[model samples]
Target: MDFFAYLTRFYLPFAFFVMGESMQGISIKPGILVLVGNKQLEIIDSVSASKIRARDLTTGEVLLISPGEIEFELKKAAPMSNPNSGQTERTSLIESANEADIELASDRYDVLLPIAGKRPISKKDMIQCTEALKLSASQVYRLLDKLDTNIGPLSLLPQRRGRVKGVKLIEASAEDTIQEIIDQHYDGPGITYQEIFEKVKEQCLAKSIPVPSEATVSNRLRERNPRALMAKKYGSKAASQEFEVRGGKVLPEEPLELIQIDHAEVDCIIVDSEHRQPLIRPWVTLAIDVYTRVILGLYLSLSHPSTMSVALCISHAILPKERWLKLIGMPDGEYPFYGVPKRVHVDNAKEFKSKNLEDSCRKYDIKLTWRPKGVPHNGAHIERYVGTLMTRVHMLPGTTMSSTKNRRHYKSEQHAAMSFSELREWLIREVEIYHKTTHSELKCSPLHKWESHFKSKNGRFSYPSIVDDQKRLLIDFMPFKKRTIGRDGVKLHTIDYYSPTLKRFNIGSRCIARYDPEAINKIWVLPEGEQNYIEIGYADLRLPNATLSEFKRAGAKLRADSKRRVPAAEVFKLIRKNDALVNSAVACTKEMRRMRERKKTRLTDSGHPLNEKNAQQVKMSTSPSPDYSVKPRPYDIEE
Candidate 1:
């Protein structure tokens, strides 16, 4: 975009990052909670992303995005500012207490927080308990007023005590005192809850089941809790504003169009069985339906970020192009393939903003959305998704192997590589699993909603909702590059390339280059008119061969009088020309002899081999012994 254009688009939108309301203390690495509505149609991402003003990456039933996606999800949920948007306990559910329910809520909180959490109490239960009990929302306060269950910082159930070792109990309950001792000691003896209860109650008999009345007490006391729990008292809640973003302002929620696509590189290394040490970077492509916070499609590859990979990813995965898109990750799908998104959101990755991709998107009426510069967190939705990638796509079968995607090696140590097929299988499996598994961060399993969504939509996935035709999908864009043939006729980065026509035509000019990195060195170059690819660069192309005959001939003729050095060049030249190389060869040989004679001074009268030189310098070669028995032969023989 030009100055004004940039101002109208990226720069203007980015200006929000500086807004007090925009950069509201959000962090690049913000805590996120992806929660699913009860209806399962509405997906919400509650971000602590106080930095940028944006929402979840996907919301449309399903989506396939890039690898290295990090998404936080609430295993449990609660309400946010919007009643439509509520928070849930990612770990457990907590509900506020009603008026009468305040005491109950407090009781529940006291009982649950130590183990489960507040929301474990149902919402209807909260409303009814509060209404019936006439407890205000000040549940904790009300709880403290009534429960005889008092301990510092914590009000336990009047029922029993948590036996924390080295911890003293005030207003001790008989059960608690014994339980504390039991908790501290018990490895040697298995003390069932029943046994503990019986002993504490000063009762006897072995079949240690809790008395039905005290079952709740025993159950609450025995349950193990995570170190943290939801607050019994309500924290400040977010307002329920149905803000629709438009013209740098919040408006009514409607016209959910733009979709975001980006690539997230995981900290994991790309490896397979073949190349143990992966040097190239493999990335995953992800597309999110902004309005729905759904992952539409994902593609993982051991290739660089290129138009081809992006195009192929979208082509193979994302289905039903009825949805109108402003920009897609790629430009345009090849003919016969349909379905195009309205807009594609991506970073300034070269592959994303590439001209080819741009042209394709333009051809298909897709709009490209670029995030603000230097504000990566601006795309926090996608960034969050990237965090979950592990090198080992799945846990190694019955082994203690560290995840390849996850780092187990010393960060400083190099890793081995994996074969292309192995890598491919791993990637495919990861994508498959991702589509199937409930997103660890997406409050609910996206796939579950996906099938239902596809079914309810009548299999229509297009904008305005049209029936999807997956078979019609086409290539939107493909990565391309130009390379020159070296004089050696070998392509760089290519170990093997060949085209009988190229060698026959013997013409080397600019040509399109394509190669499968997994295949390594095996490349194909397409000439302007050629329909097929020509592989170049092989073992034969790289090796150098002249001749050794000349050296052998020279050694056969011991030159006694000559003045040139080792005469390697002259010897080679004579061998090729078949000229009177004798004189030249003799000169070279004689020179070598003279140099050897000069360098050697340690000689015995009998001219025995000397060891005065460093032991490493001497070399012995196998040869026939001089025929002294018949007649001594000259050390340098003339053939």
Candidate 2:
């Protein structure tokens, strides 16, 4: 029998977080009302660490049970109905409140803000709250407890002192219970609403509560947010593509007004940097200006698309690219496209929705908007450009040619000659070519269109939106975490950071810590209520700088080997071991590829028994390479 077969025998209780730092998730204390299966219960007392004494809201019977027996729910507040109108008592309080009530609530909110979520408020803090609000210690505790009912300033609003005559109370409805079950079960897998309704009936029967009608359940399911439902059933990307409106292209007024960023897997196999062995196709994250159709910035990596990829792409798009172009060994090449876009449009991908990306965009006053949930045409600008780029990619050696049908009889891996760095350099040169080529829609080169917009007219030119503090711009783009500054500074990913500047801030104050994923040996900490961040390095500065990728891979290996709580030192040791192993493999692979290439070259030179025509074809395909050399000149000069 399945575990759920016995689920009906016992009721699911509301889960609670124990009063300690060791426990995680939302906290539940005494006096709070929670649902056990379908029945409402008030948390009356903590009888033991695992068991709690709760009173049944209906029967007023006090019973002791483990907190684990309950399920956590987002909607737990019991509705209190008015006698005349059947609406919750405090539902409209925030909106319908008088000016006097709003002002009073605001004052109370300020006084309690510091200690609102802090459990077991310190004696010193309790005295201060009493002094500031002119309320007793018990009153302060009661007010804080009220926050558990509903987490808002409305929870602190003035209410009637006593229950009014003919007033009615309502518990969590049977319809709501059915809806919760539907939300949980009717997604991802093929679970029907009928089956969900049956399960609800079983649970309700066990808990001795009235079951909701199937029609009620159906109505609830229909009322779910369509986008949210589709996202759960399929995926965020699919939901966006299906529901987004395919309106006509809305062009930006000028350059850098609207930029679109998206990732695509290059349709060609590439080789490794050291071994030149055929590696998996790399992914390129590209950002393009909508108005001019100019490539703003791009990041190429072997890793899949992630928050780091988007962050790097945005940073590249904002900063001047002269140094980057030179670093890729294209010193003479020109790529002038760089500026902070007024708005950036992206698909409904998880990386784009990350808090770090949102915060960084907010700081720069850049609008980060998601393309609508349904239509592919909504993101046509980026998609069309990617399609055009991939068409050119098919012309290169070792090209996969978009699909398997087009790649028939061709062994891409065998002909794969370009290394990752070589591919990157080729991509940069290709971008330059793309900018010079006449666009089908514009009837002129993208470079020309871009130049005309920023060119001096009436002794004035539209300068790009450049940031003054370039260093801070990059730092803001990095992934960040929130942690409290403790006695030993702050700990993130099991690593300690410390600095003298941290001493000025109060101990146990929560601060935002942003770190460079490339080298996380140091971090920048933004203390609470402060505008700028202070640099903090590892407590043990001797520790080697480790990339975020290495840390994740090492941590994963440890977890797979059943080491749940491996120390930071052990993980670093594993990272070093992994590096050495890769280096050793690189040497062996290089020698093997060298021997194979020599045999192929000899065959071509001697005209072996293999078909002469086929041999010639292979030679032609493999012999010719692009001329990467470009004469140094100003970007304004035409080819």
Candidate 3:
């Protein structure tokens, strides 16, 4: 018999059924624990059709038991006074049959004849059994007929209540039309069941077929495959999340096996490097290893988060930290971690979902996973790390704190003490401190955890080696754009870039240019179908320190100042001359006003506040120190 059929027949009294064994009105399958007699027993094997091989749960003794005996024991041990007594018993049965693929069986075994003895069932007994099971007299007669016959109660157990056959009320054609309407309109915004019903009515009337009622239509729509319906109406993304099986929490066994990258605007204000004027808050992108919770790399920039920032952060993560540490003036061992991660988990931000990042990851054989939107727990590790880092940033001068309410009456710009370079160094030191400090979740320093994991004898720990060509790898991760080589030069953002290597290429031929937006001094150009890129400098080399943001800002300032369009060269010149003054005038004027106020309120002698005239008189009265000339100090000095 089929599994379900067998379940409906022999194992109907019990709540659960396993394939290949039966015991005490319950199917005791292999690997299931059950209460047999006074002791719990695990069914090890099905020895025969009527007997099961079971091992004692406590004593480890093995024995055989009939299916009837197991059922009797289960009944005797069942609680008698619980409100949900039946449900509790069923739940217990199900809990015991925890083996995979077990099926729930019918609970109508009370109607079956007892299999223990061959005594014929009496008419009174048959009537009593039928009444107890709520079965008809004809069914009772059928059971009686099966006594001593091959066709027994087991043979009749598979029957169920329902029409064996029926004539269609709603024709298949009408049904198909209703389904089509549902498919077309269900996903549309603000769609409703009434609208769907109206559409189905129209289709049915036009086709001259009987229209199903609104209730029937609603039922059919509800019965449609949930996953398929969701995919059609909402989107595949929603459907996958709703129906897809999610993986459990994963802890990587090896470092660099999985990493998470995210960006956060540092909580404090910082001054510009050249102008020393307070600028907007800088952004910091961090890449952290999942296994040891160690920070792999970090990139700090004035620009907002973008695909370029993600690329730069990941590139830094893959490269050696020695040069970077020395360049940033950090100690050698401050950031010891480096290697290409096998996978990177990121949020669904446009920058992280960009084609450039996807392509770069694919090229490096790295798996890039975007966490589902609104599901913060999936990326909780990095999110928590960002929060922890921001807590430290809040303690610095000029911090905006957590919110506007928290920052009430505080001037982040006025209180700002660190320049951009200084902030960078401070962040590095903070990151070092974080590495040395014990993590709340890990209960040990990240550096210590990383070192111990590697040094352990367990084969679970593994180390990912660094890349060979670090420079080439960094270049590969930089932002790229396509341009054609021309006789004059390749123009990028109104600036001409040229290289001696371009002389070999034909004019009008296309090439790819890779650049760092923060430093527009030079770009790397790759010829079509070539693996290597040649370095190209801007045609106007004097503006070597010009960045993309500076150029844009310069253009904006010129437009605002002149109130008219001007040549690129004029704008560039204006930028070079007045870049520092462009945004510093208001701040400088405020500083100057404050200084004048201090001068005006100066205190003089006798603890009295001095006005302008009194201060001048006091300044004039103060005598300068005298300098006495030495008159040929020694007698023999004129040799």
Which candidate wins on lDDT?
Answer: 2
lDDT of 1 at 404: 48
Better of 1 and 2 by lDDT: 2
| Model 3 worst lDDT run, 10 consecutive residues | 601-610
lDDT per prediction? 0.40, 0.73, 0.68
Model with the higher TM-score, candidate 1 or 3: 3
- Name the runs in model 3 displaced over 4 angstroms: 1-247, 272-277, 408-411, 456-463, 542-545, 553-570, 580-639
lDDT of 1 at 332: 40
**Which residues of candidate 1, in runs, are more than 4 Å off?**
1-257, 269-281, 291-294, 318-339, 391-419, 436-443, 457-476, 479-639
lDDT of 1 by residue, 1-639 (tens): 232331132111110000111122222333333322321112333333332222333333442222123232332322222222211211111122123422333445434233222333456655654565466646533553432211111222232346743353333454454555345432222445565555444431232523233463365344533121111111111111112222352221222255567775433444323223343344667765544345555655544556655675555334542221112211242211223567777888787878767775775577876887755555655565554444343243211133444334444114434433344445544544555667655466545544454454466543334324332222224444576554555454322345455665444676776543222223456666665556453434322112122244543452333543433334434433433342245333433332222222111101111111222233343453332224446566553
**Which pairs of residues clash in candidate 3, taking residues 3 or more apart in a chain or in different chains?**
23-67, 24-67, 24-68, 24-71, 187-233
Q: Which model is ahead, 1 or 3, in terms of lDDT?
A: 3
Worst ten in a row by lDDT for model 1: 12-21
lDDT score for candidate 1 against the true structure: 0.40
RMSD of 1: 28.0
Tell me model 3's lDDT, rounded to 2 decimals: 0.68
What would the per-residue lDDT of candidate 3 be over residues 202-246, giving only the tens digit for each residue?
A: 989999999899998888888889898888777877787689776
Instruction: Give lDDT tens digits, candidate 2, residues 137-192.
Output: 99998887665323344557677677854342323666556767876777774667
Off-target runs (Cα >4 Å) in candidate 2 are 1-248, 458-462, 499-506, 559-564, 585-639
Q: Rank by TM-score, highest first.
A: 3, 2, 1
